[model samples]
Target chain A: MRSFDGVYEGFRAPVSSQKRSLPDSHNPAVNMASVRYISKVVKALLTFDNLIWYSSVKYVLRRCEEMKSGGAKALLSFVRVLVNIGWYAYLIVAVVTIIGIPHLLFRDYLPADKPMPWMEHQPGYTITFSDAVSAEGLASFARYGLVLGLPNLLIMLFILHNLRRLLAAGIENPFTLENARRMRIIGFLLLAGVAAEIGVNLITARFVINNVHIPGATIRANPLPYRGGLFSALLMLIVSEVFKLGVLLQEEHDLTV
Target chain B: MTIAVHLDRLLVERKMSLTELSERVGITIANLSILKTGKARAIRFSTLEAICRELDCQPGDLLEYVEDGEQPS
Candidate 1:
């Protein structure tokens, strides 16, 4: 295994050299001190080496190096393809959400007598409806679909666009200011997505309560617990700040002679 | 911004090219060029000492502090 001694030597080798040069004294104390120092140095070197090998920081740095050298071009290309797939898939879904939701109002309502598959297992309360859905109820549902789905889809489209550009730039140099800016935008959009989700849920929940009706079922619409979305947004924001700092530091390092 | 490098002047006075100085000082030409063009943010003491030694000049001869609006001497 490669050791960090070469790099560490450039930082500090004088102390180790001086310790090695201690005169050969008969005192056991001196011998013990030398032994202890050697052990400590060896431990430090091993620990440093292990950290370099095992740390995710090493992985990220190596990945960045690979990106800069075009070694990860194939992987980036693959990711770009996946992002493209997601971009178009969401686009189709967005179109369906827009067109299909309104179209549902015109379709024949579900059989008024038949139990809804979703309501079949209601344990205590029997779900009974006079009409499967009224025109107002269907219209509210369509409105909810558009209100919730469109913003999320648009945010995702924006995020994907930024990610595609970021990946493309990463293939050349991932350390540019523009890349950092793109990352920041993506982070904010992610945060906005979470907020939009909550907001839309609130709006649609109100609509559902006012417009939706059933005889025995008390319908309640609750906001989804988007913990993953929230966590990812916060993480992306932190990473963007770190990336910005790294880029600034890299600039300073390059300018330093 | 206030500390102006006199490397070009010193190099000319010493009758040495930047390449010759870079070779003697064991610094890359690109780095020396950065220093020459006044684009370098900071210089290592070791690099400064090496350049001074090769140029046979004091640190003050290679570096001068001027006011923001004043032209470099």
Candidate 2:
């Protein structure tokens, strides 16, 4: 039986050799083994390929880092960050001043009644000093100022912080994704604030008509006219939105390229 | 502004195609083109090694130092 087994093994070896030498035909088990081996080889090759790619990427990153730290590049980046921070600080001051000035001047005049027009053809309104001192009028002025000024101030601060980060990072271009994000946020806030202001004026007009009685009317009595202070504030807010849109466009262009 | 690269002239002298050299050196065609066109701001030693090996030349052959006001004839 052992001799018969050895003869069978020898026959099997020759048949396997013959099959390998043939052009097309192969055993199912042999084919499976070959497939496994090829797959293994491919995986090994892929590992090495990935290693090379990773090394190249690392090299490029290192080069960029080196450039970022270089003399003029580093100085420029610092300057840009400084300028951005300064600009935002200025904006904050401006917004605060604008909001604060009106309150400071008119704090005593709270809920100043809608002024009575003097001439039928003349288009001017006046707020008396007595009306500004009332409790409800003061509350109204404070609320208006806080609502309009706080958001603008906050937006400026947000932009300032992002710009500071970009500058410290030595980013080649300061206007990047970070600034774009902040601008979009500020834009939406500006729109909301403006809308809210419009709402407040509408509510204020209604309150004035129902609560206080005006004695004499000369010209048309629109509580809030086209050239009213609230109208100007809304226009300014709209302009800010436009500015944000411009900034967003510039950011998009940079990202696209 | 003062430094210049002479990779293109060297490649021309070696009578080797950029594609052939790229394949042999295991560098991308884009990088090789960048080097040849002198658009590359810097080169890595490993890349230099590969290029030297593929072209059968030294780094000196690929990179020539020309003085500030000197023009390559």
Candidate 3:
């Protein structure tokens, strides 16, 4: 399997020599992040590789002014394509899951410690894939789907809305007031999705995972929790604020001319 | 909110059109319009000097600081 830094270093190796040794006043990680952020911004706005963004900001605004305003015609923009693919793939997976879960639950398999037919061979051994379905399995599946799947669906809907806005907007000025508003909405949704997960974990433990006994054993559907979404949501909110500021600046520049 | 540009008066006194002053000062008409309409955020010293040189007026004559009690004319 490929390791993480190997891919990153391949992209950065050529530029590494161009960067000087870090100074005591600056943190290397912070500087690298800023450089990457600014580079991405510049690349998106001007389609240039210039590292000195300060000098090009005015030039970029001028270029934006020169570009004619109208709705974008192409239906397959990067975000739109990616988001469409993701939603469709997720839908297929969800459908399969919906079918598979019920099928698994309804299986008429016996609860026994018998070896598989393959194990009857004197020189061979075999193992069964599952024990009888636990009493709490269906409830666990429902909670998992409710908590994880619902937020994912919401995120897809938000992205679709943003894609529509982008399609309706001019190519020159992709960032509009509507886009900024949607960005903020998406950011809040992301945070809410995290909160929903936490709530689901608690509700699952309390209600869904009732202490129950099967024929011979007890079942406790303990769930593993995650908080990475919280950090990502916070980052999105901050980026939304920056998007708002960019919209304001773009408006001011447009009116100035 | 109190600061005001007296460019219209200065231009009338100098008998010069805004375009003529803008050309002589080498500043864009849009920027000069921004200044004349009191929409400018700040005036650079070099630009102020250029405007003053072309219009034959002092900085005080071109700009005024109106107090809260008085309405700007």
Least lDDT summed over 10 consecutive residues: which range in candidate 2 chain A?
Answer: A114-123
User: Against the true structure, whose lDDT is highest?
Assistant: 1
Highest DockQ, which number? Answer: 1
Q: B-chain TM-score, every candidate?
A: 0.96, 0.82, 0.93
Q: Proportion of native contacts in model 2?
A: 0.00
Could you tell me every candidate's TM-score relative to the true structure?
Answer: 0.63, 0.32, 0.50
lDDT of 1 by residue, B30-67 (tens): 99999988999989999999999999999999999999
lDDT score, candidate 2, position A117: 28
Candidate 3 per-residue lDDT over residues B9-46, each given as its tens digit: 98998899999988898888988898888887678888
Question: Who is ahead in DockQ, 1 or 2?
Answer: 1
DockQ each candidate and list the results. 0.57, 0.01, 0.04
Q: Model 3, A155-204: lDDT tens per residue?
A: 55565566455555645675677777776777787777777666667665
Fraction of native contacts under 8 Å reproduced by each candidate: 0.82, 0.00, 0.00
**Superposition error at A83 for model 2 (Å):** 26
Q: Name the candidate, 1 or 2, with the larger lDDT value.
A: 1
Estimate, for each residue in A185-221, the C-alpha lDDT of model 1 and write its tens digit.
9989999999998988887777667744566668788
